[model samples]
Target: TVFLTTHFMDEAQALADRLAIIADGMIVATGSADELIGAGSTNTRIRFRLPETSQLPDTFEARRDISAWELETDTPTRTLHELTEWALGTETELLDLEVTRRSLEDVYLQLTAEAAEP
Candidate 1:
């Protein structure tokens, strides 16, 4: 039963049960954090370190880091399952496995940016 407005995205994400993004005096988007981020544009990144000789399937658009490889995908659940299965099958040790999801701020920026576009 409380209404609050702030330019700080983290504050809104932390305190609000529901969120609405206003751009050009119009409500461009509205939803919970997960809903807005999961809609269509957001991507989850999977990062891991593996033996240099071991390679992932061609479907993964992997980029090599100093010691880790990373890829962004919309279907993280399926990707993780396939990755683990591949690791098990190849006897490859996955190191520093991390999943990074799009944040509320990212969604906010995207929504606002789209609204600004002609």
Candidate 2:
């Protein structure tokens, strides 16, 4: 048996086969990385950069910084497909496109925040 304690979520995720999140001396949640991340969320983050002159779809409320846009949605695959189709149709290149799932650190913060609520 091995026992480890650390405040770093990355370290915990790297070393532990099972994880337990404790807050205020109470074990608030326990699960593997995948389980914990999927426990309370289905949203995926999509980020991309487009030409400054290009227009985004009206349905997408992207938080824009310069030419980069970031948004979260549950249907990432479909969104990616739509973006691809749109790009092809408009003859625009999707620069720096990235898709990211919620990380262990995100899960930890969410669980801790919920545990703190009364």
* Each prediction's TM-score versus the true structure: 0.65, 0.77
lDDT of 1 by residue, 44-84 (tens): 98899988788877777688878888877888999889889
Query: Least lDDT summed over 10 consecutive residues: which range in candidate 1?
Result: 33-42
Candidates in order have lDDT scores of 0.86, 0.85
**Number of the top candidate by TM-score?**
2
Which residue runs of candidate 2 sit more than 4 Å off their true CA positions? 65-67, 116-118
Global fold similarity of model 2 (TM-score): 0.77
Estimate, for each residue in 1-118, the C-alpha lDDT of model 2 and write its tens digit: 6989999999999999999999878999998888887776655888999887888887776778865888777789998888889889999988899999878888888889988899
RMSD, each candidate, Å?
3.3, 2.5
